[model samples]
Target: MKPLNLAQFHLLIIAILLPVFSMARPGLAQIPKEASQIIDDVVVTAEKRKQMLKEVPVSITVIDDLEIQDRNVRDVKDIFNLVPNLSVSSQNQNVTYVGCRGVSPSMINRRNPFVMYVDGVPFSKISGYSADFTNVESVELLRGPQGTLYGKNAMGGVMNITTKAPSNDLEGRVSLDISEYETYLFNANVSGPIKKNTLFFGLWASEYQTRGYMENDHPDQDYYDDRNILNVRGRLRWVPSEQLEINLLSGKEIRQGGDGPMIGDSQIRFHEYKNPDDYVDADSFDNALHARFHAKKFDIVSTTTYRNATEDYDVDYSYGSSSVSHGILDYENTTFSHELRLQSPDDRDGIAWIAGGYFEYDQDKDNEMSMQYLPTAMMNFNRKTDWPCTTTGKTAAVFAQTSIPFFNAFKFTIGARYEIVNKEMNYHRTTTNLDTNTVVSSAAYTIEDDWDSFTPKASLDYRISDNIMTYVSVSQGYLAGGFNNTIDDPDATTYDPQTSTSYEWGAKTSWLNNRLSCNLSIFYMDIKDMQVTEYPSAYVMVASNAGKAHSYGGELEVKFRPVTGLILSTGLGLVQGEYDEYMGYGGEAYAGNKLKNTPEYSINAAIQYRHPSGIYTGLDVQGYGKTYFNESNQDNSVRDPYAVVNLKLGLELSHWDFYVYAKNLFDEEYYTSIFTSSIRNSYMVGSPRTIGANIVFRF
Candidate 1:
C-alpha cells in the first residue's frame, strides 16, 4: 500500500474542515427550549439507567421511531448507511457479518465481536447474529469496550434494540412498497387497549421479496434466482400496578432464497449459471418473553427465549468450469437462553450502581452431506458424507458496576465480572457409497472442556465545561473457546479462548452554540490466544490459537446542523491491525502480517434537508479503502477500494406519507463480501442501482 504524502494529507484535512467553516456565522444560533425538552424526553438504557443521550459519558448513537419511519428502514441493515463506524455484510440472506470500530473478527467460526441485545435480553445464539429487527422502537449503538457491564464478546462494542410496546391508544398503520429489480414489501402494525385497566396488545407483520442481482450464464438457465421472507409478531403488556409491568412477545419468520452464482477462477469474464436444483432453502422461528418490576429503591428484570432453524445449501463448485462440479450441503440448529438483572437506587450520597447475573444454555446440531459430480457425467460422480455433530454448552456470569462522584464536575466508575463456561461436543461421521446409495461404517467421538475468566474495568469522566467533556477508560474482554466441528484432527478439541485488554481516551464537544457536535477517540488493544481457522485444502479446515496480536485505531464523528432545516454528518476511521505470529503454508512461521478484512481507513458523510413545506431530502456517501480478503494476502484476489452513494426524498402529510429512494445511485460494480477456497473463490456482489417508492396510511 502507498502512503499519503504531506500535501495530500493537508488537503484531506482542509476538506473535512470546510463544512464547519462555511457554517460559522457571526451571530450564535440559539436552540429553542421546547426542542431541547423534546430531545431530552428520549431515554436510553445503554448506561444501565434511563438517561438522556447528552448526559451519558460513553459515545452512543441513537435512531428513534421518527427516524425509522421517515427513512423507511425496514431492516436493521438499512440503518448502517446513517451511522458512523458501522458496516454490515451478508454471505447470503441467512448469514450477516457486522463490524464496529474496525474490530470485527474475520474467521468464520469465531463469535461476533459486538454483543446484541433485544428488549433487555441478550441474544446468546450465534445464529441470532442475523436476526431481523422488525417493529423496533429504537436502536442504540454504544461504542468502545463494554466488558464490565455487558460481560463477554463486547470488545468492539454493543447494539441494543428496543421494540415498540403495547399501547393504550388505538392506532394502526399499513404500508406497501415496490421498486425496480423485482422487489416488493408489505408491512402493517396495529395496537390498542384490550381492557380498560387490565391489558394492551400489539401485532405486526411484514412480507418481502426480491430478485437476485448476479447472473448465471449456464446453458438453458435464467438469471440469478430470487428470495422471499415472511414474518409475524405479537406482543402483550400487563400493568396491574404502578410498580410492576410484564410483557410477552412471540415471533415467527420463514425465509426461502437462492444462493447466488459463485465466482469463477477467471476474473475478466463472467461465469455461467447453475441449474435451479442448486438453490438453497432456509426456514426459522423465534419466540421470547420479558418481564420487569419497579419498586421504590430496586428494579428487576427477567428474560427467556427460544429459536429453531433449518437450512439446505447448494453451490456450483466449478462455476461452470471443467475442473469442478456441483455440490450440496444441509444444516439445522436450536437454542434457548434466560437471564435476570437487578438495579439499585441512586439515593445514596454520590453513589449509584447496577448488578446482574446471567445464564445461558444452548444446544446445536448439524448434518452435512456433500457430493462431487464429474465433468463428463454431469449428474453422476463420487460422494462423501462427514456430518452429524451436536454441541451443548452453558454459561454463567455475575457482574456489577458502580458510579461515584469524586468532586464537582468529575465522576469515576469501577466494575468487574466473572464468568464460567462449559461445552461438550458429540460427533458421528459416516461415508455413503454413491453407486450403492448406502451409508458406510460410522466413526464417533465425544469431548468436553470448561473455562473460567475474570474481567475488570475503570473509567473516569471530567466535564471541562458545560459544552465539552473528556473521558478515559480501560477494560478487558473475552471470547469463549469451543470445538470446531469441521476439524478432523483429534487434538482440535483443545482450542483455547481469546482475550484482550483495551485502553481508550476520547473527548466530546458541542460547539457553535449547539449547532455542531464532534467526538474523537483513540484506542489500543492487546490480544492473547487469538483463535483462527486454517484451510490447507479445499475440503480441509482446522482451528488453532495464535500467540498474540496488537490493534490500534482512531475514530472521529461530527454532527452539524448549520442552518434551520439542514443537517450534515461525517465520520472517519483509521485502523492498524497486525498478527505477531502466524503459521503459514508448510507450517512456516509468518509474522508482522495484517489481518484480513481490516481496512486502513474508511469515510462516511451524509446531508439532509427538511423544509417547512413538508418536503425532505437526503444524500449519503460511504467509502472503504482496499482490504485483503484472505489471511495469505494474495494480491490478485484482494478487494479494491470503492465508494457508494444513495439518495432519498419524502413528503409528509396529516394522514398520508410518500417516499422515493435510490440506492447505489452511481451504479458501482463491487463485491460486499467474499468466501475463498482452493477449488474456486466466490464473491457476493453489491446490488445495482435500485429505485423504489412507498405509500403509507395512518389511522
Candidate 2:
C-alpha cells in the first residue's frame, strides 16, 4: 500500500467537506436538533453521582451512543484515539496494558494505577479489567488523581462504562458485518416494557471471528484462529412511588480464542515458530449482578461479580528449528468480588455536600500446569508440574466532598477519603528438574499485610461569566498494595502502593454563540515510592518500590463549528516524565531518563461535514513523538516518531446508510508495544492499512 502525502491528505479532506458545504448555507440549520439535545443531556459518573458534563469541574471525556455507532469501534481499545492523554497496548488476547497521565503498572501483577468501573460497580480483579464491551451505552474517562472519591487503585485516573438499560418503549436492532480479511461480526439487541410501571427487560448478544494476521509457513498450515464471543444482559426497573425507584441488572460474557501472536523475535532469521497454530489458546467468562435503590435522601448500591480466565500457550526452545519444544503451559484463574456503597443526597443550600461509605471484598484462585509434548520415556523427567495459589483482600473507606459558595462568583470545594486495606495470600509449588530427574516439592506459605491511607483534595473555581470558568485544584492519590504471584522467591510478598500529589490549573470557555469551545490545562505530579520491576533471570522478575519520580504535562482541546454542516476538533498534549532515581546496568545515573512507553508529545485532529442531501464525510489524523522503551534510556533501541491518518466517507438517506473507511491510510510501519529482556526481547508491530465499507438499513 502506498502512503498518502501531505498534499494528497489535505485534498482528500477538501473533497469530503466541499459537497456538504455547497449544499447547506453557511451558519444555517447545520446543527441537528437531536445532536444538540444529546449534548445538553450528557451526564457523567466522575463525581460518584450523576451530573451534567458542563457542570463538573474535573477533566472528562465522554463517548456517547451516537459516537460509538458512528465510529464503528469494535472494542474498548479502539476508543483510545478519541480521548486525550490516554493510550492502550494489547499483549495478547486477554491481556492489555493501559496508561493515563504517565501512570501505569510495570506489568500484570502489580496494582493498576487506573481503575475501571461498570455502571456503579468497581471491577478490581486483574482478570476483570479487560472484560468485553459489546453492550455498552457510553464510556467516560476521568483524568488526574481520583482517590478522594474512588479510593485505592485510582491514583492515575478512571474508566467508567455504562451498559444499555431496558426501555419503556418497544424497540430493537440487529446487525451483521463482514470484512475482506475474513472477519465476521453479528450483533442483536431487544428491549421493551413488560408492564406499565413495574417491569422492563433487555437482552443483547454478539459474536466475532477473524483469521490470524501472521503466516506460519510450517507444515501444519494452521492459522492463529479466534472463536465467537457470546454476551447477554438483562435489566429490571420498578417505581413503586413518586420518590422511590429500584433497579436491577445482570450480565454475562463468554469468550474463546487464540492468544495474540508475538510480532517479532529477538533473533531474526531463526524461524523457530512461524505458524499461528503454535500460539496459545485462551478463554474467559465473566458474570455480574447489581442492584440499586434511589430514595429522596439516600441511595444504596450493591454489586456481585465472578470471573474465570484460562490460557494454554506453546513455547519453542530453539530459534530456527521447529523440532525443539518446551511443551505447553496452562494458567487458570477465578475471582469473586462484592461491593456495597451508601451515598447521601445532594444539598440545595449554601453548602452542597455528598458523603459516602464503601466496602469491597475480593478473592482469587490461580493454577498453572507444565505439560510435556513428547512421550513419557523420552521426557526423562516428570512431565507435569502444578502451582496453585489463592489471594483474599478487603477494603473499607469513608469519603466526603463539600462545596461552599463564598461569594457570588467564587466557590471552594474540599474533599477527603480514609481507606483501610487488608490482603492475604496462600501458594504452593511442585516441580521436577529436567537434568536431575528428581521431584521438588514446596510447602504452602501464607502472607498478610494491612495498610491505612488518607487522601485529600482542594479546588477553587471562579465563574467569569455564564459561558466561562477558571479553576485550580490540588489533590493527593494512592494505589493499593498487592502480592506478586509471578515471582518465584518466597520473600517476594507484596510491594507498597505508589502515591502522588498533583497540582493543576485550567480554564474552560465558549464563544461565538456556543459554536466554539476550548479547554486548556497545565499539571504537575510528584510521585513517591514508585513500583518498579527487575528481572534477574530469563523468566523470573521481581517487584519492588523505587525512589520518587516526577511528571509535568499540558493539554489543549478545541471544538469548533465554523459554519453549517462543518465540524472540527483538535487536541495537543506535551508531557515530560522522568525518574529522579533509578538503578541500571553498571549503576549508572538515570535521573533524567524518560519514562517507558510514554511519548513527549502527541497531536490529534478530526474534521467532519454533513450535508442536507444525506452525505457525511470525515478525516482524522494522530501523531506521536519519539519515545524510549525502557527507563534506563537506552539510545540504540528506541521507537521512532510516527503519524497516522484515517478517512471516512458516507451517505445517509431516510432509512439507509452507507460508508467507507480507510484506517492507517498511509500504511506506516510502527511498533504498538515493546518489551526488552536479557534472554528474549520482543516488540509488537502495529496493524497495516485497512479499507472497507459498510451499509446499514433502518426499518
Candidate 3:
C-alpha cells in the first residue's frame, strides 16, 4: 500500500478531534504468538447490568473498541453489516435511522422505535443523537422488546453505549484519514490523572468534512449535500474512596449547513434544480453526571442529564416544474432526565436483582414553521403559510427485575415497569395571499392527554452443558402517544400508543476449545394498534392507529478461528411480516400488505488474516433482500437485493500504523435512504467505490 500524499496530510488538519482507532499490526507481533487461537471474551451490559456474553439471555450484538477501530466505524451507521435484522443508515449529518427487527419508525412520527443511551443517560428526544464516536468503550445492540427496563420508545430494541472513563495512567492516540469526495478526518483523544488515583481527566475532539458524491445540476457544484461536522467532549472523574466513583461529562456537536433535505420525483438520485445553494444547520449540546456507590448490601447508581438541540432549514421545493416555492423550518428540543437504580452485589453466587426509577421531561418542538412562495414568471400570485407550536412530554416510571438460580442448572428472570406519560401541544396556523392582503385559512387548538403503561418480561435460562446455554423469553413493550403538529383538524390531532408482545428462543455455544463460537435466535411478535402514516396534503402528515400486524424471524451468528492467524465470521437474518388488518394512506384498505422498508433476508460475511510480518488484510460482504418502500407493496418502488464488498490492507509498526482501503470496491450503485410520501419519493445515493488511506500515531 502507498502512503498518504502530502495534500492529504494537510486536509487532515482541517477536521476531527477523538478516542480510539488502534488496529493494523496483527500480522506481525500483534498477537504475540501467545493468543493460542482462543477467541476473545465479550462482556456486555444487556440487562442494565454487566454480564458475560454467554450468560446474557438476550440476542445481542456487541461491538468492542477493537472492532470499532478495525471496522472503521466512526459512527453507528457504519455498523449496518455488523448486526442482523437491522437497517442502519444516516439522515443528513445529525439523524441516524435504525430499523430493528421488523418494526421501524414511521416517516411522519418524530419518535424512533429504538432508544439509544450513552453512559447511563437516555436521549429523551431523538434529535440529540451524537453523530460521532470518540473514546467509546463498547456499543451493544439488544434486539426485541425491552420495555421493562428501558420504559418508553423501546418497543423495538435498545442501543447501550459506554464511553471510556478517565484513567490514572496517561494515554493518547491521534489518527488521520483521507477519502474520495474531498473527505478528510482528524481525530484525537487524551486522558491522564491530576492526583494519581484520586482524580482524572480526559478530552476528545473530531472534525469531519465531505464534499459529497451525488451529482448536482450546476456545473461547478460537483455534488450536493456536502457536510461539515465538529464534535468535542471532556470528562472529569473523582474517586474519593473504595465505596464511590463519580464522573461528569459534557459534549457538543455542530453540523454546518451544506444543503437541505434531498427529494426527487423519481428513484434517481441525481438532483436537478434552479437554486441548490440553500441548506440546513444543526447543533447539539449535552451534559451528564453519573455516580456509582458501593453499599454494604447493594450498589446504587445515579445519572442526571440535560441536553439542548436545534436545527434550521431553508430549501426550494420546486419539483422541477416552472413554478417556484420555498420553505423554512426551525426546530429545537430541550430534555432533562434523572435515573436512580440499585443492584445486588455483582459476582455473588446467589440471586441477582435490580430496581430503578426514571423521570424525563422533553420539549419536543419549540418554534414556528413557515412556507412561502415567490411570484415567478409562470405564477402570478405570491402566498405564504405559518404554523407555530409547542410540544412537550413528561414521563415517569418505576421498574424492577430479579434473577433467581434454581436446581443448580436453571435460572428464571422476571421484570416489570409501570409508567405514566403525559403530552401537551398548543398550535396555530395561518395562510395568506401576500399580494391580495387577505387571509385564506386559519386554525388553532390546544390538546393535552395522559397515558398509562405496564410492561412485563420473563425469561428462563438453562445450561445444557458447559459449552452451550439456552434461553426462552417473553416480553411486552409500547411507544408513547402524542399529537400531530401540522394538522388541519383537531379531530385528527392525536394518535394512540402502539404496543408489541414478543416471544423468543435463543442459544449460545462455544466449540473447539473456544476457537469457534455460534449463536442463534428465533422470535415471533404480535403488534396491536400499529402506528401508520397518512399524507393527504403535501408536507403535512398525520399519525394514526392502524389495526394489527405480526412478524416472525430467525438469526444466526458464527465465528471460526480455523488457524492461528485467520478468522472467519458470518451473520444471517430471515424475516416475514405483514399487516393483519389496517387502513393505510388515503384511507385505503391495505390489510395483508407487507411492512414497508423490511426485507425478507439479510447476510453479512467477513474474512481477515494477519501475517507474522506485521501485515494485515481483510474483506467484508453485506447485502439485503427485496424491500418495498410503500404500504401498497408496489414493484416499481422496491429496493432490489444488492451486495457490496470492502477490502483493507495495512502494515503495523511501533508507534505508527498505515492502511489503505476501498469501500464498494466494485462501484455498486444503491440507495442509502428511501422515503415515500404523497408529494414525492426522496432518495439518497449510497457511497460508490472510494479508495482511502489512514495513518495512526499512538503514545
The alpha-carbon deviation from the true structure for residue 24 of candidate 2, after best TM-score superposition, in angstroms, is: 35
Clashing pairs in 3: 16-206, 16-207, 17-188, 17-205, 17-206, 17-207, 18-188, 27-611, 28-614
RMSD of each candidate relative to the true structure = 9.9, 7.5, 4.1
Q: After superposition, how far is residue 642 of candidate 3 from its true place, in Å?
A: 1.2
Candidate with the larger lDDT of 1 and 3: 3
Model 1 over residues 1-699: C-alpha lDDT tens digits? 011123333335434543343355223222111112011234788877676565566767787766666555766567665555566666666665666655566453436677777665554333435444546878998876787778777766788988887666666556677777567777777777898566999898887777655556755555555677788888889988877788887777777766653455435323455555566667776677877788787878777777677777776666553535565657666767776778874233557788888777767767774545454465454556665688888888999888888768988988899999898988777766566767765667888889988889888988888878888888887878888776555475457888888888888888877888888888888888776766777565666677787788878888787677777878787777788877764585646777666666777788877776768788888777776666677765577878889888988654556889988899887766666666556776766788998776555
TM-score of each: 0.89, 0.86, 0.93
Give candidate 3's root-mean-square deviation (CA, Å).
Answer: 4.1
lDDT of each residue in 1-699, candidate 2, tens digit only = 111123333335434644454344233222121233011336776776666565567777787765665666777666766777766665555556666677777763534677787765565433435544556778988888999988888877888988877656554544555554455555656566788666777776666666645444455544443344556666666666655555666656655555444544533221224433445555655556666676676766666666566666664433333433344555665555665666655433465666777677666655554433233455554343455677788888888898787779888989999999898888666666655656765556788899889999999988898778889999998977777765456676578888899999888777777788887888999988777766655444566666788888978888788777777888787778888876653465668778776777778888877787878888888777777766776653467778788888888765446788887899876766666654445656665677776654332
Better of 2 and 3 by lDDT: 3
- Number of the top-ranking candidate, with lDDT as the measure: 3
- Summarize candidate 3's per-residue lDDT along 526-601 as a digit string, tens digits: 9998877767776577788888988899899998998887888899989888989997657788788888767788
Summing lDDT over every window of 10 consecutive residues in candidate 3, give the lowest-scoring window: 26-35
The local lDDT score (0 to 100) that residue 471 gets in candidate 2 is 90
